[model samples]
Target: MACAWEESTKIRDVLIRPGTENDCNTIMDLIRELASFQGYPYAPQITAEILRRDGFGDNQQASFQTLLAVDRTTDKIIGYAVFFPFYSTWRGKGMFLEDLYVKPAHRKLGIGKLLLAHVSKRTLDSGGCQLRLSVLKTNPAKMFYSSLGFDNLTVDDGWETGRLDTNALEHLLESSGLTRS
Candidate 1:
C-alpha cells in the first residue's frame, strides 16, 4: 500500500486543526474508514444522524475530543485522533487516547507523529498528569504508542477497566431516590 504523500496531487498546505461544525461530515468519514480497517465498521444499526447527534450535538458530554489532519488543496482529511480525560485514582488526572487513525495510504509521512504530539501538548496544556491509551495486545500500535513515550501500564491482567454510562447512573440514582429536592 502506498504510504503518506510527500506532496499531495494538489493539496499541499495540509493543516491539522481542532474539529469544527463544518468538519462533522469529514470526521464521520474518517471514523468509518478507521472502523472498517479494524474490521468492525459501524454497528448494523448506526447512522450518520446518530453520529452527529451523539458526537457533535450541543450539550453532549462525551469524554472524547476529536482532531483532524486535513489536506488544504483537495480538502481530503488524511487522519484523526480522539482522546479524553481519565481519572487514575492513584495517578490522579490523566488523558486516555481513545482512537488514533491514520489512513493506511497516509501513514509514515509524520502525520501520526504530529497527531500524537498534538495530543501530548494538549494533555499538558489541560493540566493532565499523564497521557495513557489502550491498544489491542496483538496490534502493532503498541510499538507506535511506546515510541511516543507511553509506558505500557503493566498492571497484572487481574484488573480490567470498567465502564458506566449516564443512563445507567441515572437509573441507580432514581432507584435510590437520591434526586435532589
Candidate 2:
C-alpha cells in the first residue's frame, strides 16, 4: 500500500510492502536504529546473515514478518514494522509487534499509524484478538499507544511480563535436570 503525506507542506509518497531477503541489510540497519532510539544502542544482536537464515532462508518457515515503508522519491526504506504470531493461553492466539519504527525525519507523517493498522489487520485476519507489545515506561510512545486505546496490562489487568535469555534459560533447564526419553 502507498500513502501520500504532506510534510512541511511538501507532498511525499511512501510505499509499504512485504519485506524480502534482499532487504536483510536494510532491515538490520533499521533494527539498530530502533535499538539506539530505545536507549539500547548495543542491544541488537541481529546481523544480515542471521536475519536471512531466520527470516528468509530456503526453509521458508520464517518466524516473523516485516513490512517496509519505502520513500517513493528516493526509493529508500524509511520505516518498518516486525511482527509474529504467538499463542496466548487465555486468548488462544495473538500477535506480538516486535518493533515499529520510522526514521526520525519521517515521524509525524502517519507512517507509524499505517504500519500499526496493517499489523492489526494481519492479526485479525489470522483470527487473533490480542496484539501485545512492550513499551518502556519512560518512552513517550506509551502515551501515543494509550491515545490509540491500548491498555497497560500491568495497570489494567495486573499482568506481569517475564522473560528468559539464552543463558538463563539454559541454567534453568540444567537445574531442572529434565531429560528426553
Candidate 3:
C-alpha cells in the first residue's frame, strides 16, 4: 500500500511520501549516516537487502513503515522516519518511532518536524493514542522533541531503557534450553 501525506502537509519544497523497495538503498545510507553522526561504537548491521525484505518484501506483511522526505527541486531523499505499531498495556495502542533522521545540510528546515507530524497523524488515524521513541542521552534533538511535546520517560517516570545484543540473547537462549523452531 502506498502512503501519502496530504498536499497541505508539504513544508517548503520538501515532500513526505511512503517509502518503497526502491528506496531501501537510500534509506540504509541515511541510517548509516545517522549512526555515524551519533558516534556509535559499532557500525550498523542493517543492509539494504534486509530493509527491503522486512519492509517491502512480497512474502509477508511489512513489519514497519517508512516515510521519506524528498527535496522537490532535486528529488533527493534528505530524510526518513521509520515506525511501527505496538500495544501499550496502560495506553492501549501506540506507535514507536524507530528512527527520525535528516541530513546535516538539511537541518533546521522543518523537514524533521514535518516528518514527525506526519507520523503522529498516521498513528492517530490508526487508533493509536501515543507516539514514543528513545533518543541517546547526548543527542541534542531531545530538546526539539521536547518542544514538540514528547516527554522523557526517564525523567518523568524514572524509566531506564535496556537491551540485549545478539550474543547475549543467544547465550540466554542456550542457558534456558530454548530452541528456535
Query: Which regions of candidate 1 deviate over 4 angstroms?
Result: 1-12, 42-46, 60-63, 154-158, 162-181
TM-score of predicted structure 3: 0.89
Ranking of all predicted structures according to TM-score, beginning with the best and ending with the worst: 3, 2, 1
| Candidate 3: tens digits of C-alpha lDDT, residues 1-181 | 1223433344668989999999999999999888888898358887899999999999899999999999998999999999999899998999999999999988876789999999999999999999999999899999999999988899989999899999999999999999767
**lDDT (tens digit, per residue) of candidate 1 on 2-32:** 3334334323465788876567677777778
Poorest 10 consecutive residues of model 3 by lDDT? Answer: 1-10
Q: Top lDDT: which candidate number?
A: 3
Query: How far in Å is the alpha carbon of 62 misplaced in model 1?
Result: 6.0
User: Where does candidate 2 stray beyond 4 Å?
Assistant: 1-12, 179-181
lDDT values for all models: 0.74, 0.87, 0.91
Pairs of residues clashing in candidate 1: none
Candidate 3 local Cα displacement, residue 90, angstroms = 0.6
Task: Write out the backbone clash pairs for model 3.
Answer: none
TM-score to true structure, per model: 0.74, 0.88, 0.89
